[model samples]
Target: MKIEKRWIISFLIISAAAIAGLFWPEAVETPEILSQFGKTEDIVPADVAWLLTASCLVLLMTPGLSFFYGGMVGKKNVISTMLQSFICLGVVTLLWVIVGFSLAFGDPIGFHIDGRFYSVVGNPFSFAFMDHVGVLPHLKMASTIPFMLFALFQMKFAIITPAIITGSFAERVRFISYLFFICLFTLLIYAPLCHSVWHPNGILGTYFGVKDFAGGTVVHMSAGFAALAGVLVLGKRKNSSHIPTNIPFVLLGTGMLWFGWFGFNAGSALAANGTAAMAFATTTTASAAAMLTWIFFERLNGRKVSALGACVGAVVGLVAITPAAGYVTVPQSIFFGFITAIVSNLVLNAKAMKKIDDTLDVFACHGVGGIMGMILTAIFAQGENASLLHGGWNVFAHHMMALLLVSAFTFFGSIILFRITNAIIPLRVSEASEQLGLDISQHDESLDPNRHVPMTILDLAK
Candidate 1:
């Protein structure tokens, strides 16, 4: 037979098998609630309440990240690190509503406006957000708000993503450059990538049918790699001995973030139903498993597990199970948590081997954790054609490939963006700023007075 004929035959056979699987009856199945009209009430008030709550929980993560990053840097840079998240929360909120949403979720342009430039993958403006049509909450998906509210939740994501980058350059980056990149990164990088991943018509959703339940690939991996990119561009911090500036601060941030994880995971369900309940359970389970695993490993080194280790372990577990939470069983959640903590620990410790200095260990915690979650998702997933354990080996290879591809794309794009930013503006600050601290040099405010000041919407907004 001709080679072309052989290829065609193989393709047809695979297509037939997938179709067969698609149409196959489940041995044990829940009653299907298929809907054609997509009941509007699917976005019920309760679900809306849940979504709004989840959105707030997710927002809490930024300050959590800020504290996490701030504690890792030297005292001089502590306030600056925290401010990154605060500023991003304020800025990205406005950016997303105005343009990020439109670019990310807008209808594809007709190439007629200002001659295709208007649509060049979402207005090429370095600062402008993608075109946003409006908030759209789908009844079938269980969102209670308009599409705009959903977009706002996602904007928090965009805000936090670039904020993660600050950790890599903590104690060393120029405040102005940090601001510049947040806007650039959100507008040019995050918007398009989010569109590609979440937009129904994007290539990943329409063609590949990729499933990212709650930002294993989109938020965690993307931000982690961007941290790596920034680290590559801006070298390590000056001092060598002092690892963390304040363990207490780190613990504080960790607590806030843990509280927020509920929203991040359960809210993805976009409803106040069984699925959200499942996510809530899984989120806690995975975090505990990861924390235990971390402490266990620390004890092995003839050392008691410190507060930092505990928080780090919990974060790893949280990231690892995020993608799998809604679909996998409880057992899988525990397993993923254990494995992610151990793996991230190893990667984090091996940093001395490389010249790259990921200041906050973003790659170790978020990047590796996302990969672990994605891989385990293939094993634990259930339902139609789920991979082994859930769907089996047949689906495993594809999911693994997807993880690597996502990581590579994020790493390369971030590298390019970082290099460009570095070339145009200094990425790091002078020795003077390094010694004085970012709070005073960058924002002229101090976290010292954080509580004394009245709590405005701005304060909680982060």
Candidate 2:
């Protein structure tokens, strides 16, 4: 069989880049920057240890997400769905190391407003090929841990965001085309959002005062809106209805995600301190509350409480609480969990949402949950981060503005990326390929051994 020229070209490009990377010079840190934070001796052992553990935990979440999504798709599509998530561990990592990390955490690249420099994105050259990213603490970012560790932790978040979008168009998406879309989404969308919200001098954080303790806006919201755009572009699966391949996998995935989220939320503190402990407590409290609220809410709606409902609710709580985990009290987290579950459930059941054919309810569970999280964070934040209830109208107003900005950027930006990917290669598989199932049609693999038997042979035997 002849190999496609595109595949050969892609191989050559990757090979050239890898070889060039080997010759890239090690970045030198200036004495002024090093003294601004602390010397390498100031790096706390506990902070480094905690951050290292947290980084591992966050990395585990992607595989957990794979299992979580894999069990929800039809058996014929399970491997394809899981692979879509798993592949990010490889693809996004390389992208992040090369330039994605710089675009997210490098020096400010936006214009000055009222004499304050508000960065829209990071300069790609500032940290290209991990330049200036070393074991030394960053002056502005994380001072307690190595700068490289911070980048590594954030890379996991970047990897998982695009993986989350795969669920929206699962089963029908062409794997190669989906790969291209993720590359675009991560570079163009996820990196910029990360720069805007999480970077110290970012536009949303410094200029707008948006308080995303973790990544409610950067990760979940972006994934949710992008997923919505994908559903619109891919259209519905030929047969949209199917029994889940494995409920056990969903439960397992949920458990893993919950366990890892302690790191996802608490680790944002970059220290093993009181803030991290509070974030850990709030994370679990919200998830438990959401789990119970979800099942009971379903019962009230005249639907039986199900394992699936419980899992979805728990995850929604996690999403909702993420932004406020360190900012809110335990009681506030419970409220966050309860209200977010109710709202996301309602959105999931909305007749209008039903028409969109978001295959796995990604927009409803993640997108709506993230939106609720941001809204609630704006209302309930306390202390120096006071919000509406605390008499900070300006904070509330800016959050609303930031919300609109993020929604438009992630949604419309994703649509354009989808179109570009489709132009390069079709986003949806052919109808025949869809009927045959993506696992077999795309990967030439299947869960069932008998799947290899030709239909004609089975018909002849029958």
lDDT of 2 by residue, 1-462 (tens): 557676787788789879979998876767754464556896999999999999999999999999999999999899999999999999999999999999999888998999988898999988899887788787678888988898999998999999999989998998888888888999999999999998888999999999999999999999999999999988988898989999999999999999989999999989999999999999999999999999999999999999999999999999999999899999999999999999999999999888888989999989999999999999999875479999889999999999999999999999999999999888988887888888877787799977675655333321
Backbone clashes under 3 angstroms, per model? 21, 0
Writing each residue's lDDT as its tens digit, candidate 1 over 1-462 gives 224353466467557655754665443312331221133554467867777888988899998988887887776567778887778887777667556776776554423433322232434332133222234354332246665457667766787788776766677787656766777788777777676567655554333445677878778888888888788778766653456879998899888888988888888887688988888888889999999999999899677879989989998999998887898778778988998999998898894624576767788898888888877777777787676665456567667766677778888888888777777667777655555555655555665665332334223221
Candidate 2 residue pairs in clash (backbone atoms < 3 Å): none
Q: Estimate each model's TM-score.
A: 0.80, 0.96
Name the lDDT value of residue 203 in candidate 2.
93
Off by over 4 Å in 2: 28-37, 453-462
Model 1 misses residue 309 by how many Å?
A: 0.5
Which ten residues in a row are the worst by lDDT in model 1?
Answer: 28-37
Model 2 score (lDDT) = 0.91
lDDT values, one for every candidate: 0.72, 0.91
